[model samples]
Target: MIVSRTALLETLSAVQDTVSQLIGDLNESEIKDIEDYLGRICRHLRCSRNALVSINKLPSEILGYIFQFIHADFASPSRSWIEVSYVCRHWRRVALSMPSLWSVVDLRQKGFDVHKLEAFVQRSKAAPLTVFYQNPPSDHLVLRALQDVVARNMYRVRHMHVKADVCPPFSDVILSEPAPSLCSLSLWHKGPAFPLLHANSARALFDGRAPLLRKMTISACALWYVYRITSLTHLALYNSEAHWFGDSFVDMLDGCQQLEMLFIVSPHLRLATEVEQQHSNRIVTLPRLHLFYIVRVVCKCYPLPWLRHLLAHLEIPEYCDFRVEFWMTDREVVPEGSILSIFPPPAQFHPLEQVATVKLLTTSTSKSCIAVHSKTLFIVAHGDAFPLGLPNDFLCPIARIVIVNNTETTSFLLWRTLLSTTTHLKTLDVFEKYLDTVEFIQLLCPDLGAEGVSPVRCPGLQTVNWACLSYPDVDLLFGLMAMANDRAHCGSPMRAISIWPSVNGEDKRTVEFDSLGAPMGYFTRESTDEDCPCLHVVEGLIAAATPKRPDEDGW
Candidate 1:
């Protein structure tokens, strides 16, 4: 039974009168006893009233554990976890007492709340802090507040992310004292509103080398500023301006010897710089580098030699996965052949005994993406103004190619050029719009019309998996049959063909054909493995036939 309001008020009034009567006569020990009794009575009353609620009975430790699940990324800040404190006095105490919940302070909001910021910092006490602050494009009080807080808590910060329109001259606040606890730092600068500030120099983030620093992201800042921090293991740089000189970029790569992954998306390098010219001919080797990704946008003034010089000089390990994607709107389009040369031949540097898999994905009329995977190399590229067709001689001994065509605007001539290069192609997986094209049919059977004029493409072609929307024509069916028959006569037969047909309107149908197309299974909305299990069985057969490649052969 719940206590009535009148009873609760009377009980409080009586306790207050008793306390008032003893105030003058009671000694320190008597006063302490009364305070302890009141605390116990309040807790007991609260528990008894909430006894039937399951969550209310949870221990403080359990409540703290539940609060740990709430986390927010710095890009977007949400403090919904604070709602837990408003539920009841017990919850409020528990929420405020948990330091982990207040360890991450985000000050990216337009309106700075000093009370909230101070509360989080105070509750965190000695716990390590992860701070995220973004300075608005214009002047704001939040920027000053953030600067003060960061300066004061430099010793406590473990991870810091700052994005601002103008660079802050705060090397003293960050690097005056050694940051033993700081491990990760990300700083991004939006271009200054005043052009004069654009020429402002960037000071080194840390006065001395950050011994424990392992990861960093610097954007729109001087590229060479971070060369002093040699302990970095993961580094990402994004500068849309002409901030990178070839020498500075090379020096940075050489300096960060511990880096395992490096990502760079920037404007064209300043190749004409005297410093860059001095080191343009020198080669730099990275023994431990594993993954490198570069995306660049170029105009007529910035030629391919800058990128070519860098690629030609660097000596990476066989295990490194290197990828470069570029967009060029200049009238003088760099030949696809030159871009292909950026990636070395696997056979020379990192040879694989087993055949590799290459994927071609053309998403639009002007943009395309491709990925080449081998035992040692995994290269991928994407660009709006790059070549739409895959380079045939870029990588060797490809066993499989998967083409994903998303747009109907893809050129048939481009598809033909791409297919003509796969000499050892074994399995072809074509999706959607390209399945019913005459170009695809001709690729399979080069001897269809004129018997001896042209040789058949993909001589080692074993299987074809085509996902179709419209019904395949009789001509396409006959062309495939002829190719299979010709290969069989030559003592090498095409193994199988699998077709995935989508249901259109009320036309629910199953196809049954003879030696030409009958054996190929049809997949529908309700088809199970029992109905179309040949694809899996054939894949297993292929895998079983292929042997494991040796390490030394992985090029």
Candidate 2:
């Protein structure tokens, strides 16, 4: 007989009361049996209730797909999207049936479980794998076992990344097999500068069979030989012995004609270990090569031809976005020559020559690095060593410069040097927190030149926008008025002057002409304590609610 839900519950309640009355009279074993029976009933009741829930009615395929979205290799063992499986048996069954959800096995953690790895492999079935391995199990036997598993599943492995501090024993042995399905690979060795492999036959990587490999990275490691992979498009080498490889490196480039982006970054040079070997003068022309980036290269002794010699071998496309990061090799002496060495040869187009705009934002780090790119150049430096006179002739194309959120004075020479080089600069915007607007005005409007032949600084400048820590006091206003009049007299008349957010009017209030009426725009920003009595109180409450970085002002 079909019973109503309420009637069924009433019947169950009566049975529970009858069982309670018998519990006191029953023996210990009998009571245990009754408890087990009640537990089973409770499990059935939970399943019944869950069946009535709306979401549980979703098809198993949809539920499994949703599980895949939530599943991630965040941590191991417990914190998995698979946790949803524990909520119900149906979910567990559905999750087990979906193979792709368990494909990526993160064997990077120190506390990784081999049993869990085995389970994932079994559950993944025939799905393509993207294995991430770093700082894996230290035991030699365990490493071999893990390597065995990877080798067994090599046919389906699509991507693999392995980074180990002390080069693992299986690092090279695992690459001996033909990776038919491999598409991308990254191998990083953080150990001492030792040879990456030991082989008598000089076998190349992947047995020269990674047909589908499109991207590869070799950091602080070396291969026996440069194998030709026609499909490689992106290649990045960090701290590798590319200079020592010499002709072999060029041969590798020649093999991959379809290569597009190449990155050679942060090579800590070691001359004692390597011998100077002469390379062929033949320049390899990469027809499809577009972006070539070299970053953070240092040679304590300037005029090292190692890098320049290497670059001379490659003829990249003229319009390619080539970028180089140059660090000051010798701080005591002026590094003009050292800096010049890193810049693209005077024969070719300097990347910085075409930049129309430049932006400088102060960082929290003391150490500085300079990045010169095709469309823009980012020179991150300390206030003192900030590359003054950097915007020389090559930066003449810059029409606008924006300096924002400076916590300290960058350099006096920086302002003067910029003014002298900016031949076509029309817009200058400075959002500063360290210097007063009056100070900026003084720095900007310097003497005309020797014998007054040269024009005023920024001869073609027309518009100026400035924001500072302190509000526009009377002195700042007077300084601006004087600056405007001086520029007008010098034939570089001001077009428009703008000041945004006096203090903090984040929401753009009415932007219009100021009282003086010489403006493209002006906006009344916020005022601190003076403007609002509860401002400090509200700020304190907000500050107390969240975490702050060490470099923050309040922190």
Candidate 3:
């Protein structure tokens, strides 16, 4: 069924040309239909090409290569490659004949036919499989099919990700013959733990013999079950219900020497409780760790000292909602009267060379929050509130600062910090709402500064992006325009300033301007014959803000 190479190329060329033409004409419905057709044609072509060749004709090495290309992780089912078999007979044969490609079967979809499921399991040819069940099966037929597939491939499964939407039927298959090749396992329950699979049943899956197992994730399970994973490298436990105390959780960590990445998402356990006191033993060693993320539901005491012992680098997002405890390592904590302390001992030890970026994100439900700190010097604060104050000496050699969701006061403070203090600052981006404040405009052109000293002074300043500007906010626009004009008048000149207006109701085609005239630095705006100079000024600001790459240096 494979078409000639020439025919395939011709089809591809035609499809590309058709798509390009459709793009030129902005008819969305027609474009979508054409895209669908193109996808079908591409799938069909792949199927046809795969079917034409015999297995023996291709070398075993080449066959393995083909298998690698086809074998996919079923975790992402929405990908187009999943439909390889549906293209044509040739593709179906190639796909079916390749056992490695069929190995990982995801049964998360509801109402999956048992017969087809069984056939897929059989076709996988003993290669390791990962069965995912996201939704509950409506009938016993689908359940039976799943049981049969698991039973048959019990020895071949490398990973089993189960999200039990309904109570599992505890048949012989549940109790018998655990998967020997299961190297990774994840279980997620919708509500509470099902009583049928008791602690013993949960323990049966590990049974002490998965030496190859490196990763395990469990949700809403007893802490005792986690003790069985002695060889884990990556472990994640979410909402391990209230009954499972933190002592057992700490005890479980004692055995996992190889554990590297530990993620505890939404642990309902409290830190101040007696259970935490009972497990005061520290994890003294975890040399191989590079990354750790903890998202706690309830406020917990600073676990930083313990984490410092384990990891070299960490990424904790602002919304994690946990307070950190700072415990100094024996080597780091300074002793009184020590000669070495004269140079001002480092207060805290961070393995990284510098704190790169800090982002203050504002959420709808919560107050303005300090969210992220990357190793690169970029600060982006978005909120109606002022960012928490930092000491003048707290050095952050930043290159760019982006402020979004700002009220007038927040905007004023931000401008003060950037214009007066932050010497390394380069680019400043203020959204329209922030610039609307008259106070912010006054701060930008502060009168208290040395006579004739421009309030906005960033020697390294390159670009400014002012978005959503309007007629009401024209004063703020004039201030920036004045700065640009002054800079141009001086020997040293600023690179660019870009402005995007809040064009809502007024017709863009018929907009007019009075005799105030276009500013000196304003770029020419594109307009139908009736557009004004104000629009031209806005366009000029935009042109200045656009960044230029090194490759385009001359241009």
Q: Write the per-residue lDDT of candidate 1 for residues 134-240, one digit (tens) a residue.
A: 76565456666666777777777889887775444443355445566889988776763221232223544454545778898877765353435577889887763
The candidates, ranked best first by lDDT, are: 2, 1, 3
The true-structure Cα RMSD of candidate 2 reads: 12.8
Each candidate's clash count: 6, 0, 11
Q: What are the C-alpha RMSDs, in order, of all predicted structures?
A: 11.9, 12.8, 19.6
- Cα error of candidate 3 at position 487, Å: 34
Q: What are the models' TM-scores?
A: 0.61, 0.65, 0.46
Higher-lDDT candidate among 2 and 3? 2
| lDDT over C-alpha atoms for residue 247 of model 3 | 47
lDDT of each: 0.60, 0.63, 0.50
